[model samples]
Target: MNQSNETTMNPPLNQESVSLEPSANLVRTIAVRERPANPGAWSNTVAFGWRALLKIKYVPEQMFDVLVTPIMFTVMFTYLFGGALAGSTADYLQFLLPGILAQTVVFTSLYTGVTLNTDISKGVYDRFKSMPIWAPSPLVGAMLGDVLRYTGASIIVVLIGLVLGYRPEQGLVGVLLALVLLNVFGFGLGWVFTVLGLILRTPGAVMTISWLVLMPMTFVSNIYVDPATMPDFLQTLVAFNPVTHLVSALRGLMSGGVTLGQLGLSLLTPVILTAVFGPLAMRLYRRKR
Candidate 1:
C-alpha cells in the first residue's frame, strides 16, 4: 500500500525526465528566437538607405524640387538679372549655372532634416529604434539616399545651362568633379540640419529656421554678384563665407580657371562641417527618447 501510494504521488523517473526535456527544449528555443542577430554596420546603413529610397517610390512628388526647381531658378536668374549682373543672358548663364547648382544642392539638403522631423513626430523613429541595427544607420542612410537628390539637381542645372549656351570649359572631367564636390559639401552640411531636426519640435520649424539661415548665405555670397560690387562690410562677410569658396571653386573648375588652392579650400569646407556636426548630431540622436 505504501509503495503504491509513493508511486502514485510521483510519476516514474524516466517519464518525469521525458516531460522535463520538452519544457527545457521549449525554453531554449524561445531564448534562441528572442535574441536578434546583429548585422554589419555597412550592411545596416545600406539597408536603411534602401528604405529611404523606397519612400520616394510611394511618393514621387518628393522629387519635385530636384526636377523642377533647378530649371526654374536657372531660367529665371539667367534672364532676370543676367543683363544687370553680367551684361547679357549668355554671359550670365555661365556664371549663374554653377551658383545655381550650389544653391539647389544646398537647399535640397533641408529636406533631410524636415523628413527626419516628420518621422520623429509620427513615431516612425520609435519603430526604427526597436530594430536590431546600428544606431546611426537611419541618419547615415537618409543622408546617403539624399545623394540622389543632389546628383539629380546638379544634372538638371548643368543640362539647362547647356541648353542655354553655358559650356564647361574644363570639359567632362571638371564638370564631374564639380558635381562630386557639390554633393560632398551638401552631404556634410546636411548634418547641421539633422541636429536641428533631432532637437526641434516640428518639421515646419526646421524648414523655417533652415530657410532663414540659407537665404542670406545663398544670396549674399558670390553666387549672384561679385563681392567687389557689394558694400565694404558685406564684402568682408562674403569673403569669409564658405559658399564663396565653394562657388569660386566650381566657377574655376567649370570656366577653366581652377587652381589647386581653390579646390583644396572647397574640399576642406565640407570636411570641417562634417567633423563638427556629424558627431554632435549622433550624440543628440542617441539622447533622443
Candidate 2:
C-alpha cells in the first residue's frame, strides 16, 4: 500500500505527463483579463491629495492651528488694537480683517513644509518616492491638500471679522474673489517651504527656519500698519514686499479700491516664487536620500 501510494504521488517525468504548456482551460482563463491602464498624472495627484486629506482626518490635531490661530488673531487684534489704532473696534475690523486674512494664509502656508518634513522624518516619503506613479504628484498633491487648510483658515478669519463688524464693500462676490486670490498666493508661497522641507533633516528645523523668515516678512509689511507710517528706508523695503502687495490687494478687494497694478504686483511674487522654487523643490525631492 505504501509503495503504491508513493508511485501515485511521484508521477514519472514523461512528456505527456509533465507538459510545460498550460492547459486550454487555464490559458483561456488567463487571456480573459486585460491589464489595467496606469493612472495618469492628474489621477495620481488626486490620489495623493486624498491620502494627505486622510492624514489630516485621522490626526485631528493637525487642524488645531488652522482653527485656533486665525480666530485668536481676528478677535484679539480687532479688540486690542482697535481703539488705539483705528478709533473703534468696528473701524479697526474694517481695516484689520483683510490684513488678518492675508496673514493667516501666509502663516498657514508654512504647515505644508512642516507636514512634508514630518512625513520625511517618519520615512513615509521614501515609500512615496518608490511608488510607480507621477513623480511630482506627491509634492503637488500635498500642496493641493494644503490649499484647503488655507481656505479653512481664511474662512474662519472672514467669519470672525464679519461677526466683529467687518463688512466688505464688494459683498459676497468680492469676498469670494479675495479668498480665491489669497489661496492662489498661498499656493505659490508654499513652494519656498516645500523646498525647505526637502532640504531640512528635521521637521522642527524646517519650522524654525520658516518662522525666522516669515516673522520679518509678515511684520515689516503693511499687514499691521500702513507703509507710510514706516521710515523711508522701511517704506522702501515694504514697497518691495509681496506681502504688502497682497494685503493691499485684499484690502482693495474687500473695501473697494484695488487696482490692476496692485493685482499685478501681488501676483508677481507668487509667479516668481513658483517659477524659481517649484523646480528646485522637485529636484530636491527626487534626489533626497
Clash-forming residue pairs, model 2: none
> Stretches of candidate 1 above 4 Å error?
1-38, 122-124
Angstrom error of the Cα, residue 39, model 1: value is 3.5
Strongest candidate by TM-score:
2
Give the whole-model CA lDDT for all candidates, comma-separated.
0.89, 0.89
* TM-score of decoy 2: 0.87
Q: Show model 2 residue runs off by greater than 4 Å.
A: 1-34, 122-124
**Candidate 1 clashing pairs, residues 3+ apart or interchain:** none
Q: How accurate is candidate 1 locally (lDDT)?
A: 0.89
- TM-score, candidate 1, is 0.85
For 1-289, candidate 2 gives per-residue lDDT tens digits of 9987876777764444457446866888888977679889999999888988999989999899999999998898888988998888888888888989989999999999999987866677778788788898989899999999998999988888877778899999889989999989999999999999889988889899999999989889988777777889999999887999999999998889889998999999889999999999999988877
Give the TM-score of each candidate.
0.85, 0.87
Clashes of each: 0, 0
